[model samples]
Target: MSVQIQAEEQRYSRQQIRDLATELLINVGVREQFPTPLEEIIHYLGYTIEEFEPDDDTDRVSGAVNHRQQIIYINHQDAPRRQMFTLAHEIGHVFLHREQEANHIDYRDGAMTPREQEANHFAAELLMPENHFRHTWMTWEGEPELVAATYGVSAEAVRVRADILKLT
Candidate 1:
């Protein structure tokens, strides 16, 4: 799916996005920095990450009061990194786009909604900041995999960030 990043404002820095997500957690009565695994973050907030063993068409979903307590539903068959991205994507929804009333993002093979697009942008920027990402990419031979591996994300994500930086 092609995400339209034109509408996204550059006003907020990546640190600001991270702060906002952290602030949101605090406002919801959760103390302490939400952990790194992302799944642990959900659990720390009193949610559960469950596996939908029989479902094939779904990637992940969040369920809880106001999704405050989130449940990350994923297919067990997905790759480790793909599942991590799924969790990060849902975290994008929960922290960034939930105010727009989005939930249960099914993996689509086509176009993305504007909100989804924005969330994807937010996710990329949050995961891989332009300054550090560009520096890392520049050190490489313009190979997306090298940078993606460094960021622990997909090559496409690296490409998008590189595009934003005019590095690719």
Candidate 2:
């Protein structure tokens, strides 16, 4: 089943977004894996990923998604981890907001509307699934850096996930 069918409307609670992300991961055959294979998942969902260099070096734009064309564009200058997050974030937009907009762009400014928040939550859950992340957190003794490395995400991302998960 497509992620779109799982949602009856555009507005979703955090739990609903998490469930959608988890369901997508399982549908893509990505259970119990660190650094979820976003590329493969995108392909499975019939989307393409393309990287483009920004005209300005200081551009804060992270990525954009064109749902009509099924293409996701990421800033080539971003670190691999950032690109991964952006990719996941775009995928979240694809599944969650496709009906709301034909295209969506993301910025690194940290300003989040409700839809952006839902997309961020989906990205976190997709990349670091709660069950696997919790087990890894315990295995790593609650060290965000180690968990981040294992998950192929930034230490800050790990810390944020830990905070969201209440991992102490």
Candidate 3:
């Protein structure tokens, strides 16, 4: 189901989204885990996760969350690292955009709107908290591949996050 962002929906600053993600980590008691256990978080929030193969090969959809049913649906065909990011992105919708719609389906194509941008920020912060990411980057000698493995994210994700964190 396609979800629409409400015209009067509240928009959060990137910092606010990051803070929310951090708070969620602390609340879920996964703040110290190198690779955040997204499934655990989903369960803690009383949500179910299911994986399904897309009917269309060209479908750019990655994941979606149905707040009303408390389920997060992920593309089973994606790589493990991609699935992790998609799960975290869906969780971001649960926290930040659930009020705007019952179902939030994330498409990988097209330019992102403000809500999508916020969700992406939330996912990045959720998957790779700033302080831990910084420590890991230094410990790994600034190797994106190593950091990506450590964080269960893509190497590109690590690179982008490093750039965002201004980690030399």
Query: lDDT for every model?
Result: 0.58, 0.86, 0.87
Residue 31 C-alpha lDDT in model 3: 91
lDDT of 2 at 126: 89
Tens-digit lDDT track of model 1 for 8-87: 33234556665665554455554332222565556654656766663444433322123644565665667665665666
- Using lDDT as the measure, name the better of candidate 1 and candidate 3: 3
Clashes (backbone N, CA, C under 3 Å), per candidate, total 0, 0, 0
Stretches of candidate 1 above 4 Å error? 1-36, 40-46, 54-69
- State the lDDT at 18 in candidate 3: 79
**Model 3 C-alpha lDDT per residue in residues 1-168, reported as the tens digit of each score:** 233434435689878987899999999999988689998899988899998888875368788888999999998889999999989988888888777787888878856888787878888999999888899999999999999999899999899899888885
Give candidate 2's root-mean-square deviation (CA, Å).
4.4
TM-score of 1: 0.65
lDDT of 3 at 64: 80
Candidate order (TM-score): 3, 2, 1
The C-alpha TM-scores of every prediction are 0.65, 0.90, 0.90
> lDDT of candidate 1 vs native?
0.58
